[model samples]
Target: QLRETLGIELPTNDAPPTSLETATPTQPVVPQSDHQCQSNQDQSPEPLDTSERQNSDLRAQSTEPLHTSEPQNSDLRAQSSEIIPVSSKEFMSVSSLIRGRVKLEDVNKTYQMIWTRFKEEGKTDPLTPGDMYKMGLKVTGQTGEAKLKVLRALKIVHISNKGAVKLL
Candidate 1:
């Protein structure tokens, strides 16, 4: 009676109402332009094997070793080998100073002396704290164990649990 009054079509008793959950288009959707639809249909996608072959060809082309002259390589080697001198004062200043009457200059000097001695002797093994203390005392004359603490705090040297002291 309402459909008739409003002049709107209503589902008849013979057909059920179209539900949103079941509603789906039967045909495959295509672009609106006829030319685009024709072009898309004409060209099929390339096979996986053919695309893989193209990728392998590209890989083969890129696999060749890069060429470099001997002089350029030698220049690089020389640059890497060249030692850059660092100032002891600057090095000391960069490290955190351990307070308690141990002078930074003495520590630096002691470290230099020990390093020079190590180099002179061509010593590969780690030095004992006693060896370092003797070497440090001879140079700096800052007696006792406080010098070792300063070395440790500044990270200039590392003392192992076994009392082996090694320069960092």
Candidate 2:
């Protein structure tokens, strides 16, 4: 039991998504000015896929209540009615961090925190496959094309991927 609880190492794999750069066609006429032409950078995150929907829903549900910044040691800590597993709890923390609910300068900081937690628990890696997408969707809601644009802004989704839909 002790081995199962404390000795087992959790495996996590970190795969950074490939970023696509879009090129805008140059206009035949150049405006005479002191300013130089600049290429637009895509700032949106990745769009949610079928493979990520359920996990995204689950992550969003779990994180909905934990956004409060109440002190951990306070007696008024909120109690959840659901019985959550350790893995699920960890998922929430990591997902929340990814979604920027922790309010860090960058998502990488949250990634480091998640990595450190898993490492401390004798695990080399931590994030589950779908958890990454869930975190992405939470960071950018499925509200609409504009919402997807927000996802693209974060560079979280692959735009040319088959699962991505064309938005107006």
Candidate 3:
């Protein structure tokens, strides 16, 4: 009579969920209101408090701005900015027999530097040892003259080996 009057069922931990009148196997009711949400939010705080403290410490330690152009500019450009860009077809056209242990990256860098200089200097002639030597010398930590000298020596070696060569 009391259960019929109140119209509420007591919760039993031992009862299977399937036996509950208010809960179906597929859907269980959840009661969430604005106050409940706010209470839950107040109970659990954000984890960023430690990070904020560290940031304050970092700010106190230095007067310089975190994002300074001076610091950003510290990074340097690549060494091979003076070489001309040469296609595989162009390279092969020069000589298939000119094979070396030279790296493709190094060759590409050299080509880029040459192309840049040629474009800027308004020179259209084939890439010269002097030209590459100048750029390579700067990047390879050798003198321009020395670079030219080494290239000349390599040329002699290539010719002696009977390799078809195109000099650019």
Find the candidate with the highest lDDT and give its number.
1
Candidate lDDT values, in order: 0.56, 0.38, 0.43
Give all TM-scores, in the order shown: 0.36, 0.17, 0.25
lDDT of 3: 0.43
lDDT of 2: 0.38
Clashes of 3: 12
Decide which is better by lDDT, 2 or 3. Answer: 3
Report the C-alpha displacement of residue 166, candidate 1, in angstroms.
0.8
What are the per-residue Cα lDDT tens digits for candidate 1 across 48-90?
A: 6988999988899778765745543223423543322223553
- Give every collision pair in model 1: none
Q: Which of the predicted structures, 1 or 3, would earn the higher TM-score when compared with the native?
A: 1
Per-residue lDDT, model 1, residue 119, is: 56
- Residue 13, candidate 3: Cα error in Å is 99
